[model samples]
Structures are given as structure tokens and as C-alpha cells.
Target: MPQMSPLNWMSLYILFIFVFLIFNIINYFLFLYSPNQNKNFKKKILFNWKW
Candidate 1:
């Protein structure tokens, strides 16, 4: 393996970090999971019965 200078190493690290962040962001949006929502949820009053 060729020896890399400090500047070269820094740039390589930055490049990899950016790539990792971008990949994670893409995956996060791709697999967006939402819990099942009830259509009538808004119609039901939570405080209908007061203790």
C-alpha cells in the first residue's frame, strides 16, 4: 500500500464520512415506517369521560 500524506488522509476521511451520511439519509427516507392510524381517531374525544 502507498503511504498517504496527512492532507490526503484527511480528504479521504471526509469523503468517506460524507458518503456514509448520504447513504444513511437515503435509506432513512426509503424505509419510512408509520404506525397504523385510525381514520376516526380525531372524531373520538379523549376527555369524553372525566374521572
Candidate 2:
């Protein structure tokens, strides 16, 4: 098997880390601003009332 150079591996690792951080930040903001929490709370209240 051919081995990758250290520089090549480092660059690939950096790129993967950069992409992962960007996606995670985007998902964090989406979750932070999500409107489903209100609906979920309402559902939970109604569910508890039924039991």
C-alpha cells in the first residue's frame, strides 16, 4: 500500500476538522433558533394532563 506524506495527511486532517466545525456551528445555531420547542412543551403539557 502507498503511504501518504505527512503534509498531505495533515492538510486532509485540517480540512476535515474545518468542515466538521463549520457544520457543527451551523447545526448549533439551527437548534438554538428552532421553534419546535414551544410545540413540544405544549404537547408535553397536554400529554401529562391526559394521564
Candidate 3:
């Protein structure tokens, strides 16, 4: 197999990191901005249980 140059390897690494950061930021805001009812959907189910 042919060897990768240092710049190519570095750019790939940086791109992977940048994408990871962007995904996490998007997830964080989604969690933050989601409605309270949506977040507590499971809790509401348990609250109605008789046991």
C-alpha cells in the first residue's frame, strides 16, 4: 500500500476532530432546547402506574 503524507494525515485527523465537535455541539443544543414534556415522556408513563 502507498504511504500517506504527513499533511494528508494531519488534515484527516483535524477533519475528524472538527466533525466530532460539531456533532456534540448540535446534540447539546438539541437536548437543551427540547420541550420538557418530550424530555419527561418516560416519567409520565411511570407516574400513571398503579403498582
Root-mean-square deviation of each candidate, in angstroms? Answer: 5.6, 8.3, 8.8
Write the residue-wise lDDT of candidate 1 on 1-51 in tens digits: 357687799999999999999999999999999999777665645785768
lDDT of 3 by residue, 1-51 (tens): 236687788999999999999999999987886445554455434565776
- At residue 34, give the lDDT of candidate 3: 45
lDDT of 2 by residue, 1-51 (tens): 337688788999999999999999999987796455453454334456766
TM-score of each: 0.57, 0.53, 0.55
TM-score of 3: 0.55
Q: How many residue pairs clash in model 1?
A: 0
Quick one: best lDDT, which candidate? Answer: 1
Top candidate, metric TM-score: 1
List where candidate 1 sits over 4 angstroms from the true fold.
1-4, 37-51
Give candidate 1's TM-score. 0.57
Each model's lDDT comes to 0.88, 0.80, 0.81
- Per-candidate total of colliding backbone pairs: 0, 0, 0
